[model samples]
Target chain A: MNGPSIQKPEIEFTDNIRDRNRYGRLWVYIFRFSTIIGIIALATLLFNIINQSSGYVVYEAKGDPAALTLDGVPIEEQTKDQLMRVLSSHLSKGAYSKLDRTKPFAERSRNDVYDLVVERIVKYEVVDSWLLWDSLTRKDEITAAVEEEYPEALLRFDVWINSDFLRRPQSSNPVIAGVRTAVLGSLWTIGITILFAFPLGVMAAIYLTEYAGDSWANRIIQTNINNLAGVPSIIYGILGLAIFVRALEPLTSGTLFGVTDPTSANGRTILSAGLTLGLLVLPLIIINAQEAIRAVPNSLRHAGYGLGATKWQTVWSHVLPNAIPGILTGTILAISRAIGETAPLVVIGASTVIYFDPEGPFSKFTTLPIQIYQWTSRPQDEFRFLAAAAILVLLALLLTLNAVAVLLRNRYSRRY
Target chain B: MEQIALGYPKSRNGLKRRFRVGENAILALLFISGVFSIFTTIGIVYELGKEALLFFRTPNVDLWSFLSGTQWQPHIDKFGILPLFTSTLITSLFAMLIAAPLGMGAAIYLSEYASEKVRGFLKPILEILAGIPTIVYGYFALTFMTPLLRTIFGRDVVEIYNTASAGLVMGILILPMIASMAEDALSAVPNALREAAYGLGGTKLEVALKVVVPAAISGIAAAFIVGISRAIGETMIVAVAAGAGPNFTFNPFKGAETMTGHIVRISGGDLSYDSIDYNSIFAIGLMLFFVTLTLNLISQQVVRRFREVYE
Candidate 1:
C-alpha cells in the first residue's frame, strides 16, 4: 500500500500536540464562562429587584401634621373622633362622603382613622428615592443632596415589601400601593385555567396514547398540537378576544348565568383570561401527558387485559395512576408559564388600575405581572420600586411552584 | 349462559348494554378532547384572517403599500408594515448574535465536557433561567441593561428604550432554550464517533467541535431556528423596553417598535371594536402567527431529518 516511507517529524508532532492542548484548555474555559454567563444574568436580575425593593425615600407632606393638632395633641395621639373631625374639615364634602360610603367611619378603628388622616390630609409626596445599594453605599451623598434639594422633606429607609403591601389594595399613591387585588385576580384566573385545561389535556393525551390509531386525522391532530405549542401567545389573545370576549360574551361575562357585574359587563373578565390561558397551555399539557402515558409499560396494559379489565378500566386504574406524577410535574410547569403571562391578558383588557379584589371568574381582573408592567411603565421612581417589590412576590411564587414540580419529578418519577 | 343459569338474563343484558354505552360515551368524550386542540388552530386562523381581511379592505390600507412602505404611523393613516418588520428582524438577528455562540458553547460544555454531577447542577440552573418570566427579563432590560449600556456607551448614545437592551436581554431569555435543545441534539450524537476521533489523536475540543458538532449540525440548526422563532414571537420584553412607536431603523442604539411591541401598545389602549387600530393588531398578530408557525414547522422537519440520520 505504501510506495515510499517518509521520515516522521517527531519534534513537530510533539510541538503540534502542545499547541492543540493549550487551545483545547482555553476553549474549555471559554465554554465554562459561557455557561456561567447565564448564572450571572440571573444573579444580576435578582440583585436588581432586591436592590430596588428596599430603598431610602425622601418625602414631604403638602399639609403640615402639626396644624392638625387639637390643644397640642398630635394627630397620632388624637382619638378617632378628633381624626374624623380633622378629615371632614380638610377634605371636601364630596370626598369625605365618598370615603364614609366606602367604609363608614363608625366602623373604623382609631389607628385606621389616624392612617387616613396621615394619608389623605398630610398627603405625603415622595420627592426622591434611592435604591438600596445607593442608600447603603452613598448615604452621605444622598443625605446632602436631599438636604439641599428638599429642606422640609423627611428621609426614611423604606422596605416596600411589608405585610401592608400584601394586604392593601391598589392606590395611585406609590407609598400605599399593594398587590392584594392583583394577587386575588391572578389566583382566580389560574384556578379557572387549571380547571379547564387539566382534564381536557389529560383526556386528549389519553386518547392519543391509548386509543388513536395511525390515521390521517390523528396525524394532523398531533402536528396541529405541536404547531399550536409554538404559536405566539399573543395570537391566542386575539382568539380569546374574538371568540371568548365577543362571540361568547354571554357566557364569559356571566350574562347567560345572570351574574353580570356592571363594571365588567363586557367579556374582559377573569373567565376570559383563564380560558385564554387554558388554551395557551393546552398543547403543553397534552404533549407532556403523552410522554408520561407512553412511559407506562405495555406489560401493565396486558396484565390489566388478562384480568378482564376493559380498556377504559385499564387506563383509568393503572395507566393514569402511574403517569400522575409526570403529568403533575408538567402541569405545574405549564401553570407557572401561564402565571407569568401578561400580553394575552393585556390584549383581553386587564385593567391596569383596579382597586377592588376579583370575587369570581366573571369579575374584572389584573395579575401580578400586569401590575409590575403597569407600575414599571409609570414615570415615577416610586412606582418602579413598587414594581420591583411585586416582582419579588411573583418570583417567590414561581420559584416555589418550580421547586414543587422538581421535587415531584425527582421523588416520584420511575425510570421505566 | 352464566346469566341464564343464575336466572338474571334480562338484568344481565341491560347491564351489558349500559356498560357498552358508557364505554362509547367515554371514547367520544376523549376523542372530542383530542379534537379540541385542532379547534384552537382553526380559531386562531379564522379570527386573525377575518380581522386582517377587514384591515386590508379599509380604503387607506393598500396591501402593497402596507407591505412595502417604510413609514408606520397608523394615526396618520399610514399602514406600512416595513418599519415593524425591520425592527423585528433587527432585534431578532441581534438576539441570535448573542445567543447562538454562547448557547452553542454552553451546549458543548454540558454535552461533551461536564461531569454527571456538574450536569445535574447546571441543567436545573439553565432550566431556572429558561423559566424566569419574560416580563422579569423585560424589567431587567429596562432597569439594568439599559443603564449598563448607557454607562458604557454614554447616555446620549444609548436611548432609554433602544432595541439593544431589549435584544440583549432577550438573548439571555432564550439562551437557556437554545442551550438545552442543542445539548439534547449533541448528546444524541453517538459516542462511538467521539472515540474514533480520539483514536486519531483528536483533542476533546477538536472532537466536540469537528466531529460531534458536525454530526449534530442539523439538530443544532433546528434549535437556532426555534430560538429565532421564539425571539420573533416574544412580546413582553419588546413591549416594555423596545420603545412605544414604530420607527423604520436598523440602528440598535435607537429605539424602534417590533411587531409584537406594536400589537401590545395598540391593544393596551382603549379602542373601539370596529376601529382600524383594533383591527391592525390582529393583522400584525396574524403575520406573527404565520411567521412563527412556519419557522416551527421547519425546525420540526429538520429535527425529524436529524433523527432519521442517527436513529
Candidate 2:
C-alpha cells in the first residue's frame, strides 16, 4: 500500500470526507428502513387478515336442531335426504312452502339444504367472539364470561375459513354463510372478461407493434390506450351502465337471443358486469401484449422474410408461437385484475345479495369483493369474521393466478 | 412450352391479387381492434358528459352554488361539491405524505444499494403488494388500521370510520406504484454519472442522492403524481373505512365522504333513476374523472420529458 500523500487539498478534506461518510451511512439506513416498511406493511396485512379469520366464539342456537331428528341420530350425522326432510319438518308450513318456491328443494345441493336448515330452523347465532390470543391466554375469563353472559350458549373454537364456508351460500346469519354464489359469479365474469378482452387485446398489440407504420392513426391509438389504462375504473362502470345496460339492454339481457326472463329484462346481468370489467382490463392486456410482441427479435422476422413468406405468414408462424406464453401471462394477470375488480361491477349493478348461482351471462351475479364489501358493511361481528374469510379466499385465488402466470413467463423466458 | 410458362405467370398474378385483398381486410380488422381504445374514451366522455350536463340542468341545481358551497347533503337536497372534493384532497394529501418518502427511499435502496439478486427477489414481493386488491386494503383498513389508530390516539379522538384509517391504507396501497416507477426512473439514468461521482471519492449514498436522484427528479415527480392520482381514484378502501355521511369538518379524525366513496355509496343505495341524488353521483364522478385524467396526462408528459433527456 502507498503511504498517505504529504500535499493535502486546500479544502478540509478529512473532515468533509468524514461528514460525507456519516451522511451516506445515515441515508443507507433510511433507504433500508423505507424498503422494510413495505415488507412490514405486507406482513401486517396478512397477519391482520389471519388474526381476524379465526377465534373462539360462544354460539346460541335459536332452537334445538336435535328436535328435528326423528331417528335419534346427531344432526351433523344425518344423511342429505334426512337433512332435507328434517329441514321441512321443523320449519313453519308457510316458511317451508316459501323456501320450496324459491328453488326446488330437490334441485339444491345437500350441503345447501343443510346450511339453510342450520341458518333458518336451527339458527346458529354467535353470542360473542374472542380473538385467538385472548381465547388462548384468558381461557378461564372467556369461559366465565360466556357462562355468565350466555348460560345456554355453547362455546367452540371456530376456523372461519372451513370447507363449509366455501360450500354454503351467503346468509344474513353469518354462522351458515359461505362464498359459493360469489365464487361462481366471479368465475363467470372473469370467463366472459377473457373471452371479450384477450383476442381483441392481442390483435391490438399485434397491429400496433408489427403491422402499423409510424402513422398518425397508430400514434392516436397508442395515446388512447395509455390514457385508458389510467382512467379510474368507476368511469368504465358508467360506460357499461349507459351503453351496455341501457343502450343495448336487449343484447345484454339476452332478450335479443330469445332467452328472456321478464324479471331480468332490465339488463343488470353478469354480461354487463363482465363487459365493463373487460373494458377495464383491456388497456392493461394490450400494453403487456405489446411489450411481449416487441421483445421478439428482428432477426426472426428477417429470416422469415428472406424465405419469401408473406408478412402475415411470418407473423402467424414465427412471431406468434414465440409470443404466446407472454401473451397468456398478460391475459392471466388481466384476468386476476378482472376477478378482483369491484368498482366497475358495482356500477354495472351487480347484486349484493344474490342467493342463486349465476346460470349464464344473463343471470344476476355478485363477486367475492362485492360480497366482502357487503358483509363488512353489516353491523354484525360474525359477518366481519366471514368477510375476513372471504378476503383470504380472494387473496388466495389472486396469488395462485399470478403465480401460474409468473411460472409460465419464467418457463418461456428460459427458452429465449 | 411458351404457353405453359404464360399460364404459370397468370396463375401467380391471380394468387397475388387475392392475397392483397385478404391482407388488406385482415389489416382493417386489426386496425379496428386498435381503435377500440379511442372508442372507449369517447364513450366515457359522452356517457359522463351527457349525465353531468343533465345533472347541471336539473331544477334547482344552481351550478354556481354547487361549485362554491361547502355542505353536501343529497337527501336534504343541498348539493355542494366542495365537501367531497375537500375530503378527496385531504386523504390523497396524507397518502402522499406517507408514500413520497417511503417510496423514494425504497426506490433508492432497490436501485443503488441492493444487489441484483436481492432486487430480483424483492421486486416481485413489492409487486405482490401492488397486486393486492383495493377491496382487501379496505378490509385491512377497517379491521386493523382504525383500531390501531384508536389505541394510539385514543378512542374519542379517532372515529372508528375516519379518513386517517383509509388514507393510511391507501398510502400502503400506492406505495408499490411509487417505488416501482421511481426505481425504473432511477435505473434508467446512465451509469457514467454514478461512476463519475464514485471516482470523486463520493460514498454510495451520496452518489445516489446527489447525482442519481436529481437526474431522475422528473421521473420521481411523475411517480408521485401518479401515486396521487391513484389515491384520488381509489374507491373500495375509502368506501368501506371512510364514513358514510358527508361531514364538512377538516378533521381527518372525523369521517368524511370522498368523491369515489360518494359514488359508491349512491350506487349501492336503492336510488331511483334520474333522482337528484343519483344524478349528483354522476356530477361527482365527472369531477373525479377530470382530476385523475389531468394528473395522469401531466405525469405522462413528465415521463416523456425524462425519456427524451435520459434515453
After superposing the true interface residues, what Cα RMSD does each candidate give?
5.5, 5.7
Question: What does candidate 1's lDDT look like per residue over A122-158, in tens digits?
Answer: 9899988999999999999998998999999999999
Model 2 agreement with the true structure over B126-200: per-residue lDDT tens digits: 999999988999999998999999999999999988998999989998988999999999998999999999999
Rounded to one decimal, what is candidate 1's iRMSD? 5.5
- Please give the TM-score of chain B in predicted model 2: 0.92
Which candidate number maximizes DockQ? 1
Interface DockQ of each model: 0.50, 0.47
Q: Model 2, which residues run further than 4 Å from truth?
A: A1-14, A80-85, A262-265, A414-416, B1-19, B306-311
Model 1 docking category: medium
lDDT at A323, model 2? 89
**Predicted structure 1, TM vs. truth:** 0.94
Off by over 4 Å in 1: A1-15, A70-73, A77-82, A102-115, B1-19
Best by lDDT: 1
